[model samples]
Structures are given as C-alpha cells and as structure tokens.
Target: MPRVSFAPPSLCLTFLPLLERLLPSLPPTVRDVDVPPLFREQFILSGYRPVDLSWRCYVLSLFQIHNETLSVWSHLLAAVYVLVRFLMFAVQQGGGILGVGLQGPEGQGFSVDVSSLPLVLYVFSAVTYLSCSAAVHLLHSEQTHHSLFFLEHVGVAVYQYGCALALCLYSSDTGWTQSMLGQIFLPVVAVVVWLSCIICCYADLHFHRPYLWHRRICQVVPMGVAYLLVISPVTHRLASHNWTNTSTLPLHFLQVALFLLSAVFFSCPVPECFSPGRYDIIGHSRQLFHILLSICTLVQQEALFEDFLWRRQALVREFGEERLLLACASFLGLTLCCVMTALVMKRRTHVQLLQEGR
Candidate 1:
C-alpha cells in the first residue's frame, strides 16, 4: 500500500446528482407563465417590478383613515342611507297599499289595495346601493387577483341589474304601454332588443365567450340599431303626445346620446392602451363612463316614471303591496346570507391555518 490513506467523498460531489435531477423536475418561474402580449406590454409600460412590495396591504390597512377610506365609507354611508329610505318608503307605502288608513300619494286617506310595487322598488334601490358599497370596500383587501377581477366584473352586472330594476319598477308604477310609442307596441320590441344585448354581454363574460360571433352579429349590432330606431319613434310620439315638451326634444336627444356613448365607451376601453398607469388609480375611461351613465339614468328616471304611470297604473296597483313586503324580506335575507358566508369562510381559513401550525 502506498500511503494507506482513506478520504471521504466531498459533500458537493455527493449531492450533485440529486441537484441535477431537481433542476430537471422543477417548474418554470412565475415570469415564464403564458400571458397575453398586450398584458406584457402593459406591464412594461407600467414600469412596475415583479418583486416590488404592493401597496395593497397599506391601502387595506387604511380601513381606519385615508383617501380610499373615506371613499369606502362614503359608499357605505350612501348604502345605509338608501336602506333607511327604503324602510321609510316601505312602511308608508305598505300601510296604504294593504288597505290600512294610510296616506296616498295625494295625502288623501284611502284604502290602499296596490300590490307591493313601491316597496319592491325601494328594496331594489337599497340592494343596488348595498352592492356598490360592498364592491368598493372589497376592492382593497382582495389579496388575490382573482377576487378583484371577479368582483369588478360582477359589479358591472350588479349596477346594470339595479338600473334595469329601477327602470322596470318605474314602468310598472306608471304604465309600460301608455306612452306615445309605448302604446304603439314597438317599445316592447326595442326593450327586448336592449335586454337581449345585456344578456348576451353578461353571458359572454360569465360563460367565457359563448356564441362569440353570433352575439356580436345578432344581439349587439342589432341592439344598437334597434335602440336608435326605437328611440326616434318613441321620442316623436312622446313629443307629439305632450308626454315631453317639444322644446325638450333636443335636450332629451343629447342626454340619450350621452348615455349610449358612455355605454359604448365602457364596452370598449380607449386611450388607456397608450398610457396605462396614468389611469391606474383614477380617471380610468370606464369609471368616467359609468359615472356619466348613472347620472343619465337618474335624469331619465322621471321621464320613465311619467311614461309608466300613464300606462301601468293598474299593474302598479295590483302588485304594489305584496311585492314590497316580499322584497324587504328578500333584501334582509340576502344581506344576512352574504355576511354569514363571508364570516364562515374567514373562520374556516383561520382554523385550518392554525391547525397546520400546530
């Protein structure tokens, strides 16, 4: 034997084979995930880093005080205000409609036999407000991308549904077919078209591009044409019948056009592609568009009510009472359900995490 020396293998050499195996088995990094090229371009334009600490938690921590804090609180306060208003309106309307000694719209004491239309409408308004508030507050603490994305999409639908419900209630309260063109019957056809567009757009998003081309060709494009055509005849009838004064026609047309334009803008985001971060926090095209739309809807509410009152007075009286009670109960129930589900999910997650720690 030369020197009879024995030496252990080096640690690095001993683990080299295992390390090579792991290199081959590991998945790609997060940056390597397949995202759209447009999105990639947006990221580059944003000048945002993948590893930078997000302001999300800081923003959420300000549930106590900050700009967004007040914004959140403002929406919540608005929702509460709406809820209170609904309660008051329901009490007043329900009492009258149920044949109790309740004051009617004219302050005359009469036996109210109308179904719950007034109450239902109020509840609908309250629910809409609540949904908005919930959406706003939730924007901060989303933690995960999916939650925010889904919630935003859902917010649009909720807002749309609220608007539609409010309009339908106005129609029911006054009269659907009693207006100038409403009476002529094409309004129904127009409404059907408009509603079909809404359904198609919502379905496309919710179902992930169902009947994509068909929706564009059949529902969306047709809806646009139908909307324009229906509006002309209806406006003409309204003006001639004195439902709306002739002098108001120009103003009304402008208002209607504004809403239609807003909808189009919202459906298609423009000018954001050039400068993405410029609109990241505020002044986004869609936000401005929605604000304008909400205003337009509020303005049109009166005209809609006038038209409906003339046409659907009997239907209003019929469902005015029962619908209210049912809706109030439904609102309370829904609120409770949302709260409970959120709480239960939170608790379960916490419990699971704690057990894992143990």
Candidate 2:
C-alpha cells in the first residue's frame, strides 16, 4: 500500500499565465502616487505619472490609461476639427470669389488671398491652442510641470488674440483698420497688456500651489480685457440702438458667458478637489475647462462664418491688401514672441528641475 497526497494548484502559478497576458495590455511604468514635487501642483492628482516616457509612448498614450487622457483627446480632436474648418472656409471663399469675379464688371483676377486672412489666422490660432494644449497635457511629465504650464498659458494668449482679431475683422467694416486711433489700436494695446501680464507672472513665477484660483483669475482677467476691447464695436452698436448685426450678438454674449463659466471652473477646480483620489482618472476641472473652451471656440467660429459672408465685400473695399498683410504679419510676430518666451521659460525650468534632482 502507498500513501498518496494531492495538493491544489499553486495560486501564484495558476495566475501567472493570465497575469502575463494582462501585462502587455497594461501601461508599463505607471506611477501610482509618490509623484515628484515639481509636478504636484500642475497635475493635482493625475493618477499615475508616467516618468521618462519616450515620444513613442507619449503618442501611444492616445490609447493608454492616465489622468490626462480626456484632456489630451479633447484638444487633439479639436485640432482636427479646426483644420477641417480651415479647409472648408478656404473652399467656400474660392467659390465666392469665382462667382463674384465672373459676375462683376471686369471678370478678372480676385483678391481672395487678402480676404482670407481672418480665416487663416482663425485657423492658425485654433491650431496653436489645440496642439499646444494636447502637447502640454500629453507631455507634461516629459517637460516638467511648470514649463508645460507656462507654455499652455502662452498658447491661450495667442489663441485669444487670434479670436479677437477674427471677430474684429468679420465684425466691423475694413475701415476699422485705417482708424488706428479709435479702434484697431485698442486690440493691439490689449494684446500688449495681456503679454505683460503673462510675463509678470513668470517674472518671479510663484506658480500658486494653493491659490490656484488666484492664478486663474489673474490670467483670464487680461484676456478678458483683450476680448472686451475687440468686441467694443458690438457693444457700441447695440448700445446705440443699431440692430444691424443683432443676429450674432446674442450668440456672442452667450459665448462670453460660457467663457466666464469656464474661468469659474478653472478657478474652483471642483469635484476632483472635493475627493482627491476618487476623481483621479476622470471628472477633473481641467477636463471641464478644456471642453468648455473648445465649445466656446466652436461657437465663435460659427459666428465668424456668418459675419464673413455679410462683411466680405466691405472688408475688401475698405482695407487695402498691404494693410491687411502687414496686420497679419504683426499678429504673427506677437504670437511668436509669446511662444518664444515660453520656450525660454521651459529651458530655464528644465535646468532647475535637473539641479533639484527631479
């Protein structure tokens, strides 16, 4: 006779095969807590920090898990939408020019290039904000927290200035460009002031860990001033009992309100802040901010579309091509300046992070 002993399968060995299968599906090197101090204030509980990830992994993150997934996807998709809009406007402008040229007295060449400046800037600004935001959220860990944050703000300034210019171009007659004293100058001043505000914040650069709301208000206030200056014509017309462009007025005001609410969400950062770990992967305020911002931009894009149809000829007749081109060049220069400052800040901060052993 022999004594026989039977043992159950080892739990570790039994699960090993399944674990191996799931391992490839999971993101490698996902950090759960213990995020470095530099990234703390920027992310505010981004669940798993992916450290030292390659650019390939950053792109793969389009499908991977992380706190920034929503923020990244929303803006990237917006970038696609904007590019499509840019093309759509170009095609329509071509059609309009062709139709007008054939019907007009001369039936010769047209100045579609100058007429399309607003839309071009509209596209440029949209792409800037969307791509920069997507880049920031997707690669914040790569650039260190503060550097990306600074870049994101600068991107918004450029985008805001673009939106302001677009609305002014389509909102008013081209004559506005000639009257630098009363009208066009306001927006340029506002852009300068907005840049100054951004620079001041980065001067000593507190980054405002606890007082996130203060930073939010500080950044948006100057932007709001720029917006207000650009839209003053609308305000003036409506106040003076002129109902010419009333159709877009209500929608524009609605957009202004939505943006104001976006600021509120940015400042408060609710739900996520309420339960730190609970909303780590989703439902964060930044996600909401990005969504609201996209919607606001979309609404404004539509408004510009209608305004363009109405104001196209007025724009062509009122402002010369040289003036429009110079203005576009100036806008591009200002946008470049903001971007340059952000680049410099990023490099300096990278050095700081290295010294701090992050």
Off by over 4 Å in 2: 1-32, 41-46, 93-112, 142-146, 173-187, 190-197, 200-218, 234-246, 350-358
The alpha-carbon RMSD values of the candidates against the true structure, listed in the order shown, are 16.2, 7.8
Q: Pick the candidate with the highest TM-score.
A: 2
After superposition on all CA atoms, how large is the RMSD of candidate 1? 16.2
Which digits, one per residue and each the tens of the lDDT, describe model 1 over residues 116-233? 3443443454356445544544353323322333333333333333334334344322234354543443335424433543444343333322223543454346445544543554
Q: List where candidate 1 sits over 4 angstroms from the true fold.
A: 1-137, 140-255, 274-276, 302-358
User: Where does candidate 2 clash, by residue pair?
Assistant: none
Clash totals in order: 18, 0
TM-score of each: 0.44, 0.76
Clashes of 2: 0
What lDDT would each prediction earn against the true structure?
0.43, 0.67
Candidate achieving the largest lDDT: 2
Q: For candidate 2, write residues 1-358 as lDDT tens digits.
A: 9988676569978998887655433354444456545445443555665576555566667787677788888889888897787567757767553222344478765534566676677777888878988988887764555766776777777776676667666765434444563455634654664575365347425554444555555666666676676665555444554456457766666677788787777766677666766666777787888888788877777777777778777775666777767667777777777777777777777676678796
